[model samples]
Target: MDSRVFRGGRGFAYLEEQDRFLGGTQAPEMSFGFIGCGMMGQEHMRNAQLVGRASLGGVYDPAPKSVDCALEIAARAKGTTKPRVYASLEEACADPSTDALIVATPNFTHLDVMRVATRYNKAIFLEKPIATTVSDALEVCRLAANHTQPVRVGLQYRYKAVYAEAMEEVFGRQSVGRVCSVNMLEHRFPFLDKVGQWNKFNAYTGGTLIEKCCHYFDLMNLFAGGAPEQVFASGSQAVNFRNFAYDNQQADGLDQAQVVVNYDNGVIGGFSLSMFVPGAREELVVCGDAGRLHTVEQAQLGSENQNHLEVWAGESGRSRSSAPTYPSYIAKAGHHGATFYEHLAFVEDLVSGKATGPSLADAFWSVVVGAAAQTSIDKRTAIDIADVLPVTDDIQDLMLCGAGL
Candidate 1:
């Protein structure tokens, strides 16, 4: 097992040299095939190119226009060879040279794409949430477990340095002095305006909570350091888009919602989400007895764009001493999106046999908690995570793996 690390401006590339690429010759570029050529798909392609030593094998999208878009983007980017366009996923997956596949399709189609890729024995980069329901998500996980290669889900926030540092400080060092409660607020434009009607429907996106707030729920679980014991939430379409005009309205989706969760370790978690806010703020404020930590808010950029972290410790009966400001790289100057960094990490893990971020099971359970929050809102009751789905040893093990990865 030969391991060599390559350092570049973007980040470190850990490569494991193998017999397949010996003989005093360089290995062929890793070939990647993408299933969907939508916004996220294009970003993945660009990132793979930027990371270098990777090739675009083929791109498949149901929409011919999306194929054209992918081809055009590939033409403009450096280090990207011409990519073959396929009308169906089968054609893309059938390419023998395609080393791995990325699935960025609609929510309901994740399982189908993953199942096919697993059958082909290919590594996978799937966007979250893994599935709309717990049963389907679990089945996907089962299929992944049977696969010969790694199955990585795109939860890029886990890859950010700030989040990593914060987790180490809060959980590892116990700097937070037993997290008492967490208050989180995420504001953005509506889902329908951005993702169309499918996202607005309950059948497709699994309502706003499951589709959108799963990230926060996952983060809450990470900070609380355990599975939530209970959840109570209340929400409504208080600002229906149909009643408002685009000129005066912010977005067309859920206006406001709030959820309160209780962790098994006695930590309380509070979350508020709104699509009507004037601007975006994906910020988290973590308060502990020793100090409070705030994640710096910045715009999304290429793979490197990330939020900064600042911590303040209570001293002399008052808060004093602030953590130093970390650098922020939220967006790249060009059209390339931020998801590419995450996609490259997925590919790097596959080649080097490293554990990938956000496993399928972790993404699945995030949706589970999000679904439970919706249940609480609809029933006007406090929903326990176990009540919705029994907290088995499997869930706990999955959480541990997710946190460390």
Candidate 2:
């Protein structure tokens, strides 16, 4: 090996003898702890263990069953070591072995969990929708801004191969032609019942728009390349448990919602979400001035499976266009499972002392957009993003939004 390229950590001196010299050596693996062992948490745990890049320090979930389930899965995948289970967030964060923490708790709990995690100087990987309200989300961002450790939000779509290529093709190549209009439709199985008891209450999840469509909203903003000067959106509990309750049926009332956001620029975006789709992919389309892009319906083979992207561009009047082929980036086999690619990217940043993408500041904006959408649904009117997140120089002022002390 070249002496110039090889390096070692402090306290260890490399003694390079002959090329054939044999000695036992190993690199330290990253250790990770998971908070909130819910569905997403379990998925991440499986991925991290399978990736073999990080060892599971322990997992914390208030529910005993969840903690047991997480430990079982971790032991089966890796092996039972001295992993500890805690029923509290403080226990998880205070663990000396924990190098990173994954927050997969309810929307409302994100800020509290993040606040505690930051105090312990742990790198954080928070799940989507950052928080239930804009202010709380902004506080999390503000706290993260002061920390030197890496903080990453779960916008996994950004890590997907097809999605990345599509972005490059649309924005990078400018095939989209300024993106004057965007239409997004996502229909998945109803999460109301899927989330179990949590589905009946919007206080915890922030309804369909904040909890679910927030992803689409973030993606739309990315495609637009900037914040919307204004937004007008209208949504309702048109179908599902809410409507069923009115009809005298015992339902969980978490069914469907549609929202339309109009940007200050000419671009218009529409979102359709429901748990009623029989087959997934129901529809995901992005229309631009120059061309249109679509994902294959029912493209998801598994959580780790990559979806296919089809692009139609090169104008031939309004109706004629050529279809282009794109490869998928989903990994077929890995310990980290589907999320390893993104999670490892986050871990690498933490270990290397580098900044992670989608900074908490940017994620705060996503929460602002989500909260605005929720307000629009409540007031039955279009809400401006600024109204939810008024600009201010002081971080605390931004969080309080000029509210009286």
Candidate 3:
């Protein structure tokens, strides 16, 4: 193992070395185009500046404000010039200067955006919850599978300091031994306002589960280590946006949900979400025969983010605890610094032409699990994965094995 590896920030050496190494790498600079230019798109713009090799190529959005905000971010970057504002999405996708595309469009428009993006055959970094419906997600997967350029999903939670280290402990070191169960919890404030209030309605956002909880489901699926067998969920449009109307439509998105998933390998996973909580906190716990691993990131009243990881072994072994964190600059880039690493991985794949990180199938299964959970909530019954995903064996194998990006 390299001596410079991140070891839960135990000492100053690891972080110092990490800063030097990540900051010093001479990666090939790559230009990127943006499709949506919404809140998330601007976030990608911010993180792209942190990536030594990534530069803003252009942006396209129906909303002029979004375009202006994205351009402002590009202008603020130290060494980068202002990005072009395209009048149409097609123009942005087909622009020769852009080497890659990042789709940060609304959830419902993903399939449509992808339909156009795939035609251009540029490496794409698509935001999560691939589409509003399972069939649409499957279609997106098919398009990505056929695209020549590498296509990757933005499941960046895999890079969070706590979760990344927890993944290393559970899968890399097998510290927790044979995993038997995985459980997760997220408590946070209600959804923030978006342009036109699209997120407040299931019709536009694919329900709360498909839109908000897919990231956690993706993480759960990865840790479960097998295809999901079934899902049982209970949720409601409890507090936020209730009795609230936009454009004569009431917000029907769920504000609370409890979901359980059973994997084919007999590993079970549970997730709890509360959108009305006072603060923000996320927890992941994995249990195995030998021991258990727990990691958490929490903050209150906009305080400093507290990221922690702990591993416990029974009487026969030792235990350890530590706080894992990224450098302050990186941490503030976006998504608690996860997006920085996500962009790093995307750029690496774009340059090397090797597909790693989250693939299209990962996006599919993540949406599948979320859709199943939404269905379970609607029907008040458990949803079988087989029933939800009734495709041919080849497609099933592709979805289950996660062969391509």
Candidate 4:
């Protein structure tokens, strides 16, 4: 139970030791200013309280009812204090008391949110799918890379125990030696409505892949070697909120998608998604020179078939034991308990002066590839990742990013 006090400014007051196990309910020392008090924002609110380590610095939401909703959730979660309700993100960023900020706004609003946050030197935890366009994403990266405060992109799956273990065994130890193809498949019900039903419009979500598939894209970059070189994709908005005719919501995003990527290293990575399918489940299979690793989760997996992982050591007819995943306390149905780990990891990074994150660039490129895929699907052609996204001048070297794991 070894620990150290983090002398960093306000929000990063407490830090978790690197060796600490996930789901340890130590109260966070830092105070947080949360932007966008929506469903995802409130979920993080619950996690911050559950950690018992974080306190509220302030909270921002444009809608009057939304602010009330978020405050109600915080109270229900038994958060230490009801934070100040800020009228705008700019207001939250300028406050000296606010140590760190968590940006959980919609896809379209991210650039504006980050632009405000960068004005201050506070540590930041920004949500995934940096922006709707490759250029906007690059600008956000440039701002963060140049800012003095530490920043982490919210690709929480990287913090999950299953992924950590898999990464170590396969890439770190070379158990699955050189990975050739990393494939992912997700079949589930159609996208549900968010507050204001903003997600139904491309103007708000930057298309379905950027809105939802960013996590999978981040993972694909992680396991499939590095930045993708080119992509070929196909999908249609044939179902869900639009074409299904069950609902009146007008939408123009893909309900089913398949993206094939060729990495610079010649490793091919692919992701298949179907929102209209029955029985929610996701399967990720990675094959290498040695053998392969496969993982499956029954959407919620519930109490019965909880998420599981399997590893095959080599091609010599050997297999590693497959079983239910570990770190269950933090492995809630929402994100396989990844929420808890992400909070802890961010806190640890803040306190310890160490940050191995879904780096800003790492986050940017996931959208970059996805945006390109959308282009490929629409135009019926193969698109190169490097061509669509250009290198920035001096503020940020785009090459140094996009490769971060």
lDDT of 1 by residue, 169-218 (tens): 67776666768777778876565443344565566776678777877787
Local accuracy of candidate 3 as per-residue lDDT tens digits, 250-354: 889999999999999999999999999888999999999889999999998568889999999877378999999998878888889999999988988887876
- Tens digits of per-residue lDDT for model 4 on 1-405? 422222213454254555434323456588888998887787687677655567877889887777888788667643257788987778899888877898898888888888889989899888888888888888888788778888888888776656766777677777677799999888887887677777777777888888888888888988986768999999998777664332565667788999998998988998999998766777778898888888777754233444667878755556775554644444552466677778877878888878866788778878888888888988999998867776646324567443432
List candidate 1 segments past 4 Å from native.
Answer: 1-28, 172-174, 192-196, 243-253, 298-308, 316-330, 333-340, 390-405
**Alpha-carbon RMSD, each predicted model:** 6.8, 7.5, 5.1, 6.1
Q: lDDT, candidate 4, residue 50?
A: 52
Better of 1 and 3 by TM-score: 3
Model 1, total clashes: 6
lDDT of 2 by residue, 268-343 (tens): 7777776665545634466777777765434342443235666677672333223223222124322112366676
Instruction: Please give the ranking of all candidate structures by TM-score, highest first, separated by commas.
Output: 3, 4, 1, 2
Number of clashes in every candidate structure? 6, 10, 0, 8
Cα displacement (angstroms), candidate 1, residue 275, comes to 0.4
lDDT on C-alpha atoms for all candidate structures: 0.69, 0.65, 0.87, 0.77
The TM-score obtained by model 3 is 0.92
Q: Between candidates 2 and 3, name the one with more favorable lDDT.
A: 3
lDDT, candidate 3, residue 263? 97
Candidate 4 regions with alpha-carbon error over 4 angstroms: 1-28, 77-79, 243-249, 300-305, 314-318, 324-329, 391-396, 401-405
Best by lDDT: 3
What residue pairs clash in candidate 3, if any at all?
Answer: none
Is 1 or 4 the stronger prediction by lDDT? 4
| TM-score of every candidate | 0.80, 0.79, 0.92, 0.87
